[model samples]
Target: MAQYKTPGVYVVEKNAFPNSVVEVATAVPAFIGYTEFSDNKGTSLAQKAWRITSMAEFNAYYGGPPQSKFSINPLPAADPKAPPVTGDFSITDSATKQRTEYELKAEGTSYILYYSMLLFFMNGGGPCYIVSVGHYGDDLDADKISAGIDTLLKEQEPTMVLVPDAVRLSAQDCTTVQTNALMHCGFKMRNRIALLDVYDGYKDRQDPAGDCVGAFREAVGTNFLDFGTAYYPWVNTSIVKEKDIDFTVITNLDVLTDLLKKELSPITDAANPTPAAKVKIDQLNAALAAITSDWTKSQDPATDKQTLNKTLLAVSSLYPQIILAIQKKLNLLPPAAGMAGLYTMVDNTRGVWKAPANISMNGVVSPTVAISNDEQEDLNVTTQGKSINAIRSFIGEGVLVWGARTLDGNSLDWRYVSVRRTMIMIEESLKQACKAYVFEPNTANTWVTIKSMARNFLTSVWKRGGLAGASPDDAFSVFVGLGETMTADDILEGLLKVSILVAVSRPAEFIEITFQQQMQKS
Candidate 1:
């Protein structure tokens, strides 16, 4: 209302159209893992959520990939019949007085965040958030994972949740973390997807129907399978390189070998060395050369020391590449992070309803387990509805993501990942759009405006092939009014209710055709 005392004429503008509903993005994933560092321009971000838009940004903040992990703790039994470690060398164990046999394995903490992010962005992942629970060398147990998950609760932008290091936790602890993740995505956020990875043992198992999948199912429980998805047979990646492991951490093998030999028995102008002693000396010298080439100059001021370091002190470094190659081969990454990357790729190229399956995965060398169609039958269409998607490598197609069902495999409504994601997109969009009419008068005009807004949004989705219907009416229906969606008492109670029914499009999981001999008549 304007005051008449002003004695002036004024032209006032008013909004002519109702508020429009804008579809929310459904691809941003928040990965929880370990990186080389967690600092942003000298500011510590450990155990905190940080936004990274590009690889350079992530590198500048969190640093690059750390070295692969390896150790020789689990040694083999000593052979009494075999010749002793003679002539030049002696071995010592921390626990026992002396050690005889050593078995080197990549069993230390894996600094996978940098490489996982590399894979994610390489496979078409876009701007996303990272909840770095800790840096390399930090223990990532169930408590740390759960704490990492809690950081995402305040973030509304992330539509997908992934814990790439879930395999590192103990079985019971992993179950606790995953259960909490399901709760966050399903009951708490309701707008995000939980991409989980099976236990590491599933990657190399000879049997698919036995304890592997059974262990996973028992741990994940049955409550909110619809909110999350599990991927099977971890992916063997080439992302790790020998150069990534800082070689400098190893001691000079030749010098140590000579010192041990001299301590055993002084050789002053003694006879020629035995063949076994010569072999040991040669092995030591070669390992020392490798360390001198890579590790000795690693401390130079010009060298970038962001990469991590690993040591296999107990084993022979005669051919370090053999051990390093084994480490790379054993670097079986869980599928959650990769799936997040695929989710973003598919949602961008095709709409959310388009299943992210039968598509080749970038940055993957091969699937750890070769899954045939018969093996995938139980995985894709399981009776328990605990669908585990498979990653299989075909001859020409490369390693492709083959399945697209959600954890709720048997449900008609929320079976496929696309259907679940599509509904989330729509639901979030409509909920945000309705915020504009929160305290507006509850009248026919308001009801009509809200209904029109929702209908326009759904109609656009249908036009873009997100919904299934021959007409907009058949595609979706929006009801909001005095008699349609709410009663007189509901209005008095300050309740503005709207009932929306939509025909969500489902993926063609199975495409079959009927053929008959009569067709020859045509």
Candidate 2:
């Protein structure tokens, strides 16, 4: 028996070169030894010992060799690029003109294409198919079919590639499958038809050289079809549709742009080269010179005198206008009357005033003694002596009589009411005056309290009939009482007290009575 060189069984002929044969025997299956078989299998036979020619002859004779007990690490699975599958299909028979709809189920390798198809659909790709063929008994047949499909793909340069579905065994069963696979590969397939010729042309001794041409043309036509209705406005683009707004009210774009540029120019210019502050010292100096010259010329005795008189008359005539201007500038004015009058008097006096004299009599005179200027005037019967007597009578009678009358006509009533009212007025006015003085000097309510007290006191006395039908002595006493209450060491206070006393006393003789006597001795 002759052993085979390869590790497969083979048949051997016992004949020599001419034809001398004895018995026909099968060759022993040789083992091809490697690292995996080194331990159990002995050293390999020499290459010179075998004369194996073909794998076919070897397998034909010794194909039932003992299987090697060795471990094999299976190869990593290939990431096959399977196309997509269709879920359902509607088929129309051209001859019968009948339509049938069927739901397609995916299996085996077809499921992979279906999954890819689903992913494509999710990613905005269109639908496609799986073109499958029936079961091939061996890998050789599968290789042949795969090679034929690869050749067709390369020659036609189709947008999509198709492969057999492992579960579907017939081309008719997988028609929609092929359509779906193409769609999932981003190929649009509609309006045009695809015909798949599945006959094994090579095995059957027929040529398939031009078979895919029509199918390729159909695919190209489908791909380039003008299905204008399929193009939707909202799909495949990100442009935002906007509604119209009335823009007439807004400034023009060019105008706004120009304005913006103008505005920004200042800032940019400022950022680069800063501008210096403008100096007006020279102008101010010129103005000052003119003002000083005018003022000096106006101050001349002859010129100033006339100018002063003119200015004073002008001011008097336009006093309201001047006051309005002043108020606009200063927002206030001094009180016009009342306390202002009292303050003006105090200001004029410069803190001092003459007081009225108090009159008193020793005793009343008897009835008339006549005076004669012609007769050598007796000292007792002269006009001067009678005048003195009359004066004494007036003081004596007036004080007692008017004082009694005032007492009778509720004198204490006015006194109490006046005192209380005056006190309240003084308190309120003092607070107001103090606040006004603090906030606004010109508007200060100066001497308000003192003025109020003096006015109230005099009014009270006058109302009590002390000023009416009263003797000088009675008037003097009333004035003295008012002066005593209103008197203060302060200039304003002194002026207020004096003003009221002058009004109250109605003095015939202006006597400079001492204010120290009138003031409270403390």
Candidate 3:
């Protein structure tokens, strides 16, 4: 009420309601990894948090995916008793009437962040932040990755942290990155969660080296387990289509050319070569020569690259095999980015309380290693209480996320992912709403207003099925006052304290049915 001047009648507007709590986004993830480029026109987004809503925005600002190169090598001799590694295949030489085994090995450290970004967008991810530590060809340095994680401190919108490139580092280094991420989310930020991927997740649990899940549990340490979740094994995705690959991806062009020539020797060495065979040989030779030739001399490198691709596809039969192998290599990606997208999709469609499990993943062909129910038991519920989620493939369900527990599986308070995330959403939303009263007098009037505002906001969440109760009163409680959450000393020290308690909904991870014989009612 303002003092009236000159005895004139005055009307004062008074707000009857306290400021409402605006729910913070629960799934905008921050991705820290290498990108092709981070140039938004002239400005560089290197090691900075940049928000992008769509893949188009990402490509425009950060360029496109990496050009991963592979080398075709003869498979080394293996003990007959040992099983062959994944991705190993055999090709028969028709002229020699013998079969030869071969494997496609990555030429160098394959930069997977670009491909992982594609996977994230493919799986229904929405707005996210990208922190490019460096360009595509830079080494995967742990210090650089840790620095990138630090960049997110200034950005408050992101609720999850994912470093898809961390899996490319050695086990020790990858664990270091995961540790840093967990610490950042749980200890430093206290408002976000970290989605982690097991190193060498494609390998089976019984791999000769050791159990991948066991190694992850041992190395991930005991701090802030509730703030992170791990998924295994890696998924074989369809993000890299056949059309995206070409002969240029093969680094051993000389060896590939020799192999193609040998394949064509049956027709070339013929005493009386048919006209069709001669034409085929000539076209193949021209394509090979063009590929080997210096492309800098070409007037248009872009068109020349496309023409060379089409020529190789049309003339060489072995070229398809090489391209397929390369595609597979690129498609075997860690599961963190895809999980980040899943979180976003689930949060958007359902509330943040919904468990992101038992849902089939998009752009996923299958899990790299099949896990039977018996095998997943160990992964789902371990002795050390470090639970790792399983991406399992059912007979008709395709590839599905099978588990929903956090790393601290044994703790009933923060066991499920949904419970933890739901709490985070509530805490953050109310925290923002209370900021309006930061310097206001910490008295009974302010306390009542804050409590009413929180109750109203939580009523909405309860209606949305985020809390486990029949009524708003049963779902949550908010306390703030001299005797409740704060004492006289606390108010004297300028501390306005608030305490909240909510019974978050938990997922029905297991259901059992019982059947018994009954007397005929009729």
Least lDDT summed over 10 consecutive residues: which range in candidate 3? 84-93
Per-residue accuracy of model 1 over 453-519 as CA lDDT, tens digit each: 9999999999999999999999999999888899999999999999999999887878999886655
Q: What is the lDDT of residue 473 in candidate 2?
A: 36
Q: After superposition, how far is residue 343 of candidate 3 from its true place, in Å?
A: 0.9
**Candidate 1 lDDT score relative to the true structure:** 0.76
Clashing pairs in 1: 248-295
The global Cα lDDT (0 to 1) of model 3 is 0.89
By descending lDDT, how would the candidates be arranged? 3, 1, 2
Best by TM-score: 3
My TM-score estimates for the predictions, one after another, are: 0.82, 0.12, 0.95
Least well predicted 10-residue stretch by lDDT in candidate 2? 228-237
lDDT of candidate 3 at residue 239, scale 0 to 100? 92
The alpha-carbon root-mean-square deviation between model 3 and the true structure, to one decimal in Å, is 1.9
Candidate 3 structure quality by residue, lDDT tens digits, 1-522: 565668776777888988888999999999999888999889999999999999999899988988888887887656669975344556667666766777888877778888888889888899999999998778889999999999999999999999998998988999999999999999999899999999899999888899888889999999999999999999999998998887778888898888888778888889999998899999889988988888747889878888888877887777787787778888999998999998989999998999999898999999999989998898888779999999999987799999999999999999998999998999889889888998999899999999999999998999999998988889999998999998889999999998988988889999999999999999
Top lDDT: which candidate number? 3
Model 3 TM-score relative to the real fold? 0.95
Better model by TM-score: candidate 1 vs candidate 2: 1
